[model samples]
Target chain A: MTILATEALTKRYPRVTALDQLTVSVGAGVTGLVGANGAGKSTLIKILLGLVPASEGSARVLGLDPATQGQEIRRSVGYMPEHDCLPPDQSATEFVVHMARMSGLPRTTARERAADTLRHVGLQEERYRPIGGYSTGMKQRVKLAQALVHDPKVIFLDEPTNGLDPQGRDEMLRLVHRIGTEFGISVLVCSHLLGELERVCDHVIVIEGGRLLRSSAIGELTQASQVITVEVEEGLEKLAARLTETGETVAVEGRTLALQVRADETYDLLRDAVVDLDLNLVRLEQRHARIEDVFR
Target chain B: MSQPTGVIHDIGYRHYDGPRLGRGAGAVALWVYSLRGTFGLGRTFKSKIMPFLLFGAMMLPTVVSIAIMALLKQEPMSYTDYAVFMQPIIAIFLAAQSPVLVAPDLRHKVIPLYLSRPVTIVDYIGAKLAAMIAALLILLVVPLTVQFVGEMLIDLPMPLHTHEYLAALGGSVLNAVLLASIGLALASFTPRRGLGVASVIAFYMFTLAASAVLTGVLESEGHRDAASWSILLNPFFLVNAVQANLFGTQPTEGLPFPSGAGPALILLAVVALALTGLYARYRKALAA
Candidate 1:
């Protein structure tokens, strides 16, 4: 079922149109909003949250109109903004509890949920310390904790792994995945990175230049493509030239070669070329289409 | 770094089935949060230092007045006069603490987190204004109550003390309204806490300096009525004028705008203007 949807929605500023007649719908499970900077991703979230009024069209969040019923919509949905929004002087538990209260939770319930949510986000004894001294990953956890403290029906996480290292990113992705699957909360996680979302999201919505580019389930978009990813120990350029000489579609990206498969013979042609050139082959496998391919 | 940290340990995610209150509760929560922050409650030790010191300083003179009244067995100062005389301390409190409600949110860009909740822009503003007003009322009422109790015990003038105490309390409310609205309005303009502090103090100082200079010049020029009106330039005097007129007490500044209820209406207008300024500022801030 559709949890959040915007139809022909437009937001015009004096200098530029932030969202130009954009239309998109997101169902349950983890959905990713992929876009470059200035691609109107943040603007769309603001419109859905009723932070700004749209110039035209209509939208619904959790089946309530954001334009007229923002307060009600916000009560059911949580937003983890991209910017730094944590107060330095406050501890994680204190800030999260206060945010729970802001969502209209009673004091005891707020405190209870804050503790549970902070622990759920992987913050342990450090929850008692001031957030000013927390690392970026920990701060991101606090941001996530606050978003989940009131048990929002749907959570909008903007760049949940924006500042994390590879290891941190993996951990955060796991957390996002659990929130979607284990907790039964619909998730809309926004990020510029495609590969990260490929791991956590069940559906991906690609946007560009304030318009919808594509919206599809992850399995449909990331299926094995007609192109085969060819990685070699050496002779990458020689292999590309040889594949081209054999009348096979081939493209080289850095050390990796992308050879298109026209028929079953495409794989046989690549294997024979590597053996004939006396080059060590590292990998020759069917390529899964990347979410980044949407931009192309 | 604190321990062997990265542990993927999660119990289960429990769904909240408890009662979620409406907008009124959300707004009250914000008010309570802001009010506690005003006096540095639930904050760091360094943050608590200034507010507590100011609270004690505000109460010092009232303590002294009570001591003198107990021993002398005479009227040292009337209850209303304590509020009028303690204007500078209250001004200091307003100037120093108003930014505590707004500055951090602006500087840290946390307003979105707040707006993303059930609270509206007007609810946020109203809660904050209510919080600051409550803090000021506490600062005034505590000392005033102490003096009222001490005087009653020493003199045994129950009816007179109760009447004057209630009058002083009414004046205290006026003082809180005028100071908090104006102070918060000034603080909301600047995002930097230091700058917020400076603007609030500078506004009070400029009005006071202007009022003091004009009052002196007008009195010397024999424009006595103009001198009385000049005191209204400062908001503290504006509240004083209204309070004096309402309770039939003489304004220490000059005549209490002998032209009935006009000063009270004008003071109300200033409060209205300050509130309008705050609303406009936050609306613009939220838009950005």
Candidate 2:
């Protein structure tokens, strides 16, 4: 079921329009909002959260109109901002408990929920330490815990893995997956990276320049990434010779090679091909589905 | 190697199915949290220093005055005079603590988190305003209450002292509103606590110094009317003028307050403007 939707949503600043006639519907599962920075991802989140008024459009969260029933909309929806929003002085537990109270939980329940949510987010006794001493990953955990402390129905996480290293990003994505699956809470996670979301998101909406580029199921997006593209600084001919010798069709375009995955072994063969040829690999990405691929 | 058959128990991730309190509870929670922050309660030991130091300084004069009065069997300082004389300490308290109440949220970009919840702009600002005004009221009223109790213990005339104490309390309310609004308005503009602190203190000191010099010069030049008008420049004197006119207490400026509700109305207007400024500030922050 659709938990939130925006129709013809547009937000304009004095100098530029942040969101422009963007219409999208999100259901009760993990939905990825994939867009680059300055591509109206934050603006759309704020609009859905009812923090800012859209210039010309209608929006709803949890079936409540954001313009009129903004309070009711926010009551069920949580938001974790992309930026560094945590205060340095308070401990994570204290901050999350305070946030729980802000969400209208009774004091005792707030405390109880704060402890549970912290543990759920993999925080331990370090939650009692001041947030100023926290690593980036710990701070992100605190942000997530606060959002989940009151048990919101849907949580909007803006770039939840913004500063996380690769392993941490994987863990965060797994947590997001569990939130939508195991915990049965809906999630709309925003990120600029396309590859990291394919594994966790059930649905994906791609936006660019404040406009919807594509909205599709995870299967469709992943299907489009089956064709791997690789770019190398030199020795492209030698690499292509090695790949073609391995019985895979290689298309050449300006020193970059595009190959379709005939089997799961194709990726290993491709990596070996480059290493065997001693090619200076400038780029090696399987998920580099271009804008043309998206439109297609 | 044989796989060990270890079963893992369920750890967590329970749904919160309890009753959620409504807006009133949320507002009260925010207000109390903010009030605690004003005095650095539940915060770092370093954060506690300025507020407590100022509070201790605020109480020192009243304690010494009460001790001396009790022994001498005479009145030491009037409640209104105590408020007027401790204006610097009160100003410092506002300068130091008002930023503690509001600026950190801005600097840390915490406004979005609050607005993203059920808390509206009005609810958030109202809580903050109430918390700060309450803190200011407490700072001004506690000394008045302490001295009032002290005077009663010394066997001062019950009727006269009670009446005077009530008037001071009334004046203290006005001062709290005026000072809190101005201080919070200044604090809300920039997230830089240093700037908020400096600007608030500078604003108070400059106005006090300027008012004193201008009034002194005007009175020396025999411009009694101009001198009386200049008293409104300093917020403490503005409230004192209102108190003098309303309660007929001794004017702290040592000048006859121009009669009527003019001073009171002007004080009210300044308060309204500052509050409006603070509201506008948070509205912008929320939108951002």
Candidate 3:
């Protein structure tokens, strides 16, 4: 089921068009909003969360229109903003528990939920300390914990891995994946880096210049192409000749030979080419189109 | 990950997973932050003690009065003398120190966290106002109260009277609320701490000086009512003028604006208008 939908939503800032005629339907699981800076990623997320109003068109979050039903939508949807807005004087425990309480939880329940959420986000030891003294990764966890503390049905996390080193990025990505899969929460995670989203996101939506580019499943975007990349130690030209002689199409691409073999005869074709040419096969890889290809 | 050494741990804490605090705790925490921010603590040593120490130095004359009274033969202190000498000094301290309570949060973008939570804009403003008023009360009222009590205990010439005590309390509360509201309204204009502080001080100082000069000019010729209206432009002067009127001690001998209920209601209305304007500007900034 579609958890969120935007019908021809557009938002125009003073100097730039932030989101232009962008229409998208996002369902359950981790749907990645991929774009570079100035790609309207943040604008779309804010609009969906009802923090920002669309200049035109309509959008509904959790079946409530963001225009009029903002407060109701906000009550059910969580948002982790892109910028660092943590109060330096506050501790993680204090911040998250306050958020939970703000979301209408009872005092004891809010405290318990805050503790549990903070632990789950791996911010256990230094949670009592001031956030000003926390590292970048720790601060991000606190931001995440606050968003989760409310126990919203869906979350809009804008650039969750921003400003983190590689290790920190990986750990954050893993946590995001767990939130969608294990915790049973639908997530709309935004990122400028398409490669990272390629791993964790079940569905990918691309935007550029404040407009929608493409939206598809990760599998479809990265589906294996018709060409098979084969590397041989010797007889590269001979293998190409033999493959062509057998009515199979072949071309040399860089250091590897690209071949088009019939679907059923693909394995047998590789076996015969190796035996007849007396060649050593070094590498065999299927040529799949990456999400980056769509950008180009 | 393994925990770092003690020194690193002191500087770099991992996120903790403890029981969270509620609204009361959150307000206390915010109040503490505001207090530390006002005193400029948690940073350089120079900034740490400078604000409070400077304020104490500014109150040297008041301190000297108490010291001399204890050291030598003393006469009864008149209410008029206390109002003229001590009240203005306390007003300066209160007005000058207003922005420190809120400027840091505005500059650091720290207010969003609080606003995004369950707390309303009203509570945020209320807590800040409460902290400033409490500080002012501690500095001004407590000492004055002690003086009033001491006069009764030592059997001074003029013992404490019910009317004097009630009048003083009511007048100070009005002055405190008026000053705090004006201070917050000025502070909302700027996000920089220095700029915010400077603006409030400059606003009060300029208005006080300008109104005094204008009042002098208008009274020397004619149009005393027009001069009374000039007090509307300057909150500090208006507050002082209204308080004088409240106490039946208008400086001008000619046109009396009736300082009793009319001035009080007008002052309250003006304060309410200023507060509403300040809150409107704040909400606009938030939307921006």
How would the candidate models be sorted by DockQ, starting from the highest? 1, 2, 3
> Which has the better DockQ: candidate 1, or candidate 3?
1
Q: What is the DockQ of each candidate?
A: 0.85, 0.70, 0.20
Off by over 4 Å in 1: A231-246, A252-256, A268-280, B1-10, B156-159, B253-256
Where model 3 places Cα greater than 4 Å from the true spot, the runs are A13-17, A89-115, A223-225, A234-253, A287-289, B1-100, B111-160, B211-234, B246-277
Q: For model 2, how does the per-residue alpha-carbon lDDT over B186-283 read when each residue is reduced to its tens digit?
A: 98888999999998999999999998899899999999998888978999889988998899888874767777998999998999999899988877
TM values, all candidates: 0.94, 0.88, 0.77
Clashes of 1: 0
Count: clashes, candidate 2? 0
lDDT of 3 at B76: 32
Candidate 1 DockQ vs. native: 0.85
Worst 10-residue lDDT window for candidate 3 chain A reads: A98-107
Candidate 3 lDDT over residue span A111-136, tens digit each = 87788888888886899888889999
Q: Write the per-residue lDDT of candidate 3 for residues B1-288, one digit (tens) a residue.
A: 988656422221123244444455556555554555555555345554655764565355545544545555354343323433454555556545676676656766656555444454566777777666666555555545655555555543443454554555555666667777777788877766677767877776787688678877887879778777765455544554566667654333233444556666778897797689778866775665
Which prediction has more favorable lDDT, 1 or 2? Answer: 1
In order, the interface RMSDs are 0.7, 0.8, 6.9
Q: Which residue pairs show backbone clashes in model 3?
A: A123-B15, A124-B16, A126-B14, A126-B15, A126-B16, A127-B15, A127-B16
